[model samples]
Target: MNFNQKELVKSTVPILKTNGTDLTKYFYRRMFKDHPELKNIFNMSNQASGKQQHALAGAVLAYAEHIENPEVLINVLKSIGNKHVSLNISPEQYDIVGFHLISSIKEVLGDTATDDLIEAWTQAYNELAQIMISIEEGLYQSNLKKSGGWKGWRAFIIADIVEESSEVKSFYLKPKDQDLIGDYLPGQYLSVKLFVPELGHEQVRQYSLSSAFNPEYYRISVKKEQNNSNSPDGIVSNLLHGKDKGDEIWVSAPSGVFHTSFATDHPLVLISGGIGITPLLSMLETNKNSLQENPTVWVHSCRNEKVHAFKEHINVLNKDSQWLTTHVFYETLSEKENTSVKEGRIDLSELKDEVLIDNAKYYICGPEVFIKVQYNSLINLGVAQEDILYEEFGPQLLHFN
Candidate 1:
């Protein structure tokens, strides 16, 4: 962008900081109203809860803050790109988003939104959208070139289902065309696009692969999101729960940056709260199957054994593994459950220093607050920020200190 454009964009940083939320909330309302068809692709549940608005607000604020040096935000771009790829986001869709976004800004800013300022954001939006488009194109190409990969959404048949817990179940999905699927990195997620009869829309949702990479099939364990006070009930997850074996569902190729398959000699520490264990379980199984000498520890927190998915599976994996050990915390024990389990939230301090190797890399997943608390706790325990990693369930609300 030209100097005048960059200056104008930078000048809006303060305004963004103060009115980001209100602006994005308005943006979504305007976009959905003008383009209600997008409701099929966007998560209405998140939209209703204001989660997507919050995410867009943070993204815009960050963009305005670093408009002159967006290269510093490349990592953020990659994360967003990964998600876009999972949802089969096409480059053309950016035009729709950009148009609505620009309109939203003008509508929200009212008299203060000068033509030049609006023009600056228009250029800024296009530039950022191009970068995302390029990244997503590369991702799509890589996925298609893989042995068992296809672009966009592919039909998959549910071959089997395994009930993991009272709340979670694992669905084994195989390609209907009998094509090969690429070997995805552990901790990555696949987006499932299913037609929800109730919503009368095809909804897309990402579920972490719960098993090791398989060429013929993918295993995804889904937790039925029970509706309560904090949030609206899950639309897609509940739809998935009702799906029967042999039914077909459309799924995008795997995409994510939170995997641990990259070369790292450091010990591995996998921490999870509640159903966040899905992807971490894949990483654990991948590492174990690789037969590497890396020491691995699984620390999980859940309501209790009844709701704890993978309890038996984990025990079976732990039976003879010399390098693997598990520490579990249950909020309460069941009548028939054993007593060695501790009560309350996850307390990493309880583990010995040896278990948490000084140079061990930590991969944490869970709810937003749970992951944030664990991240800070790990930092306080002397774990370097670089050594700590997290997988957010949605647009990141937490900031690193």
Candidate 2:
């Protein structure tokens, strides 16, 4: 944890950067072999896709790359903090991961892994783990300070359940004690933990808060992954789909960076694709009573009416709020619906031609491909990159650029 340790790790970062994937693969292989108990800790499906390995490797490389500027890695570490919390990744687990990571480096590097080199990586891993542990500890404290709060994860009774669509469902959760809850920022997400027998332990996934933050209960809208019935199915989403009223599920306090602050007079443009509408809807609801001068434009894209999650709710908000304007685009629709719902997705040309108003802050959240392509397009359309905010769903999707 010494400065020299970070410096040592920094010196060898280039080599680690080049072999990041190999290192991560080695790390995971050794981890699962030595501590097979961790098999339940990671998402096997993502590991199979090579996404998780690449993601962890990318982060370690970034840490080395930014060793001199650790402050710059705060956001990156914060995102990781959120993911770790959701995954139930504890401080103890960090030791497990760190132990094997160093071992992997020694095994892979062989003759190159001198005593000094090993010490450097050991210290670097400890430092990095400390940062994550501290951030996560702060998060735990924040959640615990609330009226109805607990550390780690706890079972919450399902106060109510509403069906949003054939594929999507909404769950209203309240602590078993039935006490008031702390308010969360609009556009934040909550991690629900489900104990899937097949998956073992518990698996976590993030779902955006569909309803405005209320002190009484939290609402999360989820789309069941029905795309592959032949597969085992989505761990959290599937578990949520079958549960009914009066059931119990574990809930974490809402946490995310994407938020709508009416404190600023800046104009706002909220864009979403598919079920990404959840967070935007929360933003609109939170701003419904605001008297801000700048307008808030919501442009949402979906396949059609059947799968669209919050059409009626959005329509009602549009009627009630004058500062809000709703623009709907359906990719595959009837000729009339296509004209009514502004056909296709939101792109650079579409923003330039249709979405007007400058000096506005843009907030986007959705699938990896959609958010990335649209975010880049917005920059191409002359929007300042600094003013744009986004939150990706999983740990693998890093938006450094």
Best by lDDT: 1
1-401 per-residue lDDT for model 1 (tens digits) = 89999999999898888888899988888888888888878887777878889888998888888888988888888888999898878888899999999999999899999999999999999999988899899999999888877788999999999999999999999999987877899899999998878888878888999888877699999999878987666888888899999999998888998888833477899999989999999988888788784788888999988899999889888887888888889988776777767778886766756455867889999999889888888888788898888988877676673
Expressed as tens digits, the lDDT of each residue in 1-401 for candidate 2 is 56776778888778877888888988898998888777655777677767888999889988888877878989878977876775567889888898899999999999999898898888778888999999999887887897665666667888898887667788898887676666777888777767778766656667888887777788988888764655656667778889988998777777777787634477778888888888877887777645553578888887777788877888887787778777887777776553557766765565575555777888887788888887888877888778888877666565644
Error of 2 at 293 (Å): 7.8
* Candidate 1: stretches off by over 4 Å: 229-232, 262-264, 352-355
| Candidate 2 regions with alpha-carbon error over 4 angstroms | 1-8, 36-41, 228-232, 262-264, 289-294, 336-338, 353-356
Could you estimate the TM-score for every candidate? 0.96, 0.91
- Against the unseen true structure, what C-alpha lDDT does each candidate score? 0.87, 0.78
